[model samples]
Target chain A: MPKEYDTFVDDLSTLPEGKELILAIRDLAPGNRKYDTRVVKAILASSANKLPEGDILWLRYQRGSLRPEPWRIKIIDEREGLLLKEKVYDT
Target chain B: MPFRDNREYIEALEKAGEVVRVAQEVDWDLEAGAIIRRSYELKLPAPFFQKIKGYPKGFRMFGGPLANFRRLAIAMDMPADSHPGAILDEYHKRAQHPIKPVIVKDGPCKENVRIGDQVDLYELPAPMVHDGDGGRYISTWHFVLTKDMDSDWVNWGMYRQMIHNSRDMGGLFLPTQDIGVMYYRKYEANNIPMPFATAIGPDPISALASCASYGVGRNEADLAGGIRRAPVELIKCETSDILVPAHAEIIIEGEVLPYKRVDEGPFGEYTGYRSSPRMPRPVYRVKAITFRNDPILTVANMGVPLDDADICLSVCGRTDIKTILDNYGFPITGIHLPPECSGHMIVVAVQAKYTNIASHIANAIWGTKLPYPYIVVVDSDVDPYNITEVLHAIVTKCHPVRGIRAQEFAVGHPLLPFLSLEERMWGKGAAVLLDCTWPLDWPKEIAIPRKASFKEIYPKEIQEKVLNNWKNYGYK
Candidate 1:
């Protein structure tokens, strides 16, 4: 089974990476989730002085310890609501 | 734009070119109030004071934060011009499904720490936001903590804290509020002081949530988690068992002595008037302080429209009123937290699915948790956000005795100006529940024919062309 995060350091950096990656883990969290990713793209676009819909992934961090990875993950868009979800794949 | 904290929020505004930073030093006295008032009158975004007349260079101040409902909406991660009704609906929905806060050991807020004797309140440029104020108030945006009398669940609320001295602070102890009631009960049983902590500049959403009058026993921090979706990161206080935002700018850990009370305010309030005269209130004794480097202080201007007092408190009242009514199963169609009355007046629009729906909604709203609502419920189509429409429903649809209900001796909001006007003014007033639903026997459809209009037979392209080229007709 996939590992769960027991510490803060692991939780912050374990966020899903991009669109394809986020789709796999959307419904694992117990509460409703809202994903806000505009800034990731906006910051990237602003730095380049051009708008290109920069890539920033969003996902819901579900409840449950990482050693057993009991929760699922839900991806969402601020403007569009829910995007996708994926079951925690065991190692 | 998204922000990690108040400092980060301001930084985002500056980066987006939405804010104008004043480099020149401005006095924290009346001068700051004047500048803030001018910003509101001009409908400009709030200003950031990089340099104040007093205090160290790194001590920054923010004024007029969330002065407008639109701005408050933006802070809640909604569109700039979103209506209060829409925002509150979302708030209620989020409250039911809460995301727990994440516990973190360290963050940027720990960059600098001040504990014990080194902690000096005078070092920060906390502004005397209003004239004739007791002293430079520090609690405009601070969260005051008190645990539930029965449960250990912590209660966080944005009650105003006034700076009396480096070691002492005084705050309102209104008997109606949860904090006041809880503290009094503890004092009565223990016959000793109750320890409390005041946190300044936590995450913006958390600060906003604290201002909301969530029902007793429910932790406002959970509401903050709901607002953010992701769990809010929290850190335990160094001096007390209380938990504060890991990223908060400053935390003042203190206790309120059971028998001690001091003169707190003659300060201007949200009702567009200064409270009659000075009065003694409960005092908070500072025992420890923890802060980050170059900490930024936030202030809310009182005594005028669309200031932080209104924006923040209004959201609280609005959310509380709606939540209470919804909890009672009232078919509420909409609710408005008008900036005009500093959110004291609440107008609810109900669908009125059946007869007496208006009266039920009105009574439900009036009897709800937030004490006095000054409620007016109209037909769903009336659009409660439109002052003109709400008034029209009250005037045309409501028959005085049939629609209105009066409540006497009900507790009033302390900030209400009318309270201080008369000798022992009734701390209460009558609430009108306009029965705007059509007469009981009336048919649903209107019998009259449609009025004539120019667009009846016009094609879409032709209508658009006429509108676009209207000036060419020389109508002027």
Candidate 2:
């Protein structure tokens, strides 16, 4: 059988606070791709870095050129969070 | 329709509140350019010059109003901070899978037609954009229609045309550019002058795409169709066999004759300076001038950095880079054509799956038309968008001797002031590609200091709690 595939955040709306999203990426990122998760984080953090108070920075990060893995950021309920939707386009 | 014509696109701009109309009479010389230069310096929306000093009331002029990065993104239906890489991604997605343009029988551009000796080039208000410019340039946003001598392929490109008089003007049909090469071959083989048509004030997307280096023989108009998600309506010109975008504000139909020459520039080019002393350039003798009832003149403020070079050419370079790398089967994580570099400086981030991946990326870039006069390739970990971060990767990951490779004797573009300044013009120059990847000799499991320190992490509950209380803590 093909290695059982797991779906990442199916709906970006359910993503929790900042630390939770980072923890989720840590779980998903493995071995050679360890640095990719960090790259995604920096890109996500930048959007919210200078937002006015309570303006959440919602963002998503995706891989590949065509269909970028849905990496999104939104300021939800005064908290910044990221939603990594799926492995969009494999290199 | 992708856009019915130039007027339709202008209407869209007006509707979006992205354009501001200056009703005062503006001179084509310093006043028009000053307004444009100010818009660029302020990094504001594109400017529309409603009145030209000598032109009629209805004869509109478009200037710096929509020239900056912010306005370009707005027009393309993207967010404000849409970087060059992101925009390139947009173009790449469209170019590879182009939505072919639909053909229509007639369009508004056909509303007015002038052919033969009646074509008066002097009637149009082609802006004398900069002080040091040799003559009034008519083709920054102007697209030239030329066909291949053998295969009969059509090429659309932005070549500079200057006004010499009512019937003639200096044109840069550079040997490297398709127009120059096509004209050269036709002049040599059939002993016939090359027929050409110039269009100004078409759709913003078409104007922007014309600035792209879409390889030598590729049809940019079709590529433009893919971006607009509809066909670019084209109408046959009155005097020439060439076809121009149907809605172009104005069309200059003419033939470039043999043994005809004029001194063209000393104009402020995109390199931020006058292109040395004026040199001999090909002349396009206008045979006819066609336009809609109320024709709008388009202006591209040239020279002194941040003009067409950054906004137009840089976007083209980045788009081509990403597409070229992907086509070469390289794991290019990202690419950036920073505005500061006049789009000639390219930084690439690639996933280093194997040894010499950096070199591979470098080779891929060098082999393409968008080769930056300077290139730096880095490990996927570095953010190509972040200049300081890219530099850090270069400093930390690269060794001077082992990392640097040079390609000598590359065909350089004349606009590259650096190349013209160099001693040898033909392939005598060299390009530096830095391999800023981890040393290939290192162990696969090598350990580096942990990047996540106490400052980088916090419990989710605590972070959420603090953010929720941000107002209570006195910071908005």
Q: Per-prediction count of colliding residue pairs?
A: 21, 27
What is the Cα-based lDDT of residue B183 in candidate 2? 75
Query: Candidate 2 residues B31-141, lDDT tens each?
Result: 778888777767655678887777777887777524566556654667646775676677668767555555566766666777776665657777767754555676666
Task: Give the poorly placed runs of model 2, Cα more than 4 Å off.
Answer: A1-91, B15-17, B78-86, B102-105, B400-402, B420-428, B443-476
**What TM-score fits each model?**
0.75, 0.75
Scored against the true structure, residue B275 in model 2 reaches a CA lDDT of 40
Q: For candidate 1, what is the TM-score? A: 0.75
Residue B243 of model 1 has an lDDT of: 74
Give the 10-residue window scoring lowest on summed lDDT in candidate 2 chain B.
B420-429
For model 1, the stretches where C-alpha displacement exceeds 4 angstroms are: A1-91, B15-17, B79-86, B400-402, B420-435, B441-476
TM-score of chain A of each: 0.19, 0.22
Tens-digit per-residue lDDT, B393-425, candidate 1? 777777777766656555565456655433112
